[model samples]
Target: MADETESGERGNVKTGGCLCGSVRYEVRGELRPVVNCHCSQCRKTHGHFIGYTSADRNDLVLAEESGLRWYQSSEKARRGFCHQCGASLFWEPTEGSSVAISAGTLDAPTGLKTVRHIFVAEKGDYYEIDDGLPQFPGTMRGHPLPEA
Candidate 1:
């Protein structure tokens, strides 16, 4: 179990919350680069593409959770949101300690960058992904999720 600070990163602590401010949280580890997910579930749940950055579960601390709710989206995954404001929040693998934090929920100065666009085949018909980053037609099973 290596401490997050051992990565030569700063405190590696970032605070974020839902739109209504009722579901604040703190992430205290290294965050993977932001990935724009265009899977149908994500598009529908967020009413558009969803951006996320992941961190180990052990490093996350919930400071306030009064409005948080978790929806088991699939056998292997769950989605989290704010009940008070309907703000999409988290995505976590059911069997792992890692969780994906909604990139939009983090306060500015995130010090993060978009690493890639995933599930592009299921993207909405209304828009195009022309941001110049690598676009994968599906998940990162064959392809790898890039590190920041």
Candidate 2:
């Protein structure tokens, strides 16, 4: 696999559209730390554990929002989805500094590098996280790390 550093230096912009293609977005800046979230809510929302990445909201641009939907998942967090097809798109902290874009939503070759695993204790019993990334016992809410 190509390293994220090499891929990022190429400025290969990653773009994705909703399942129905009504909503589209482009991640234009360098991709940073990526994470796999195993929280119950995430698993329920995506029908599986979700992969996410931390990025400055400014780095994300909704090229089209005709089918976008925002759900306030909690007092401090909200999740964006495709209203037309109910495809989960991204998660953002209501007051934090960054956004967590669904890694699977991005078109392949996004230069995203997985650096950690979260909500391990709450993870579904059906799958195992085999990646060597750091595992946190729960959600990463107030840590000094980036949004993912």
Best by lDDT: 1
Runs of candidate 1 exceeding 4 Å displacement: 1-10
Q: How high is the lDDT of residue 5 in model 1?
A: 49
**Could you tell me every candidate's TM-score relative to the true structure?**
0.89, 0.83
TM-score for candidate 2: 0.83
Model 1 lDDT tens row, 4-106: 3432233557878998889988888788899999999999899999999999999888989999999999999999999999999999998977999998887
Determine which window of 10 residues in candidate 1 has minimal summed lDDT.
1-10
lDDT of 2: 0.80
lDDT of each: 0.87, 0.80
Q: Pick the candidate with the highest TM-score.
A: 1
Query: Which lDDT tens digits does candidate 2 get at residues 1-148?
Result: 3334533322446677678887788776666677888999999999998888767888888988999989999998999999999989889999867888888777766656777888999999998888777789997657555542
Provide backbone clash counts, one per model: 0, 0
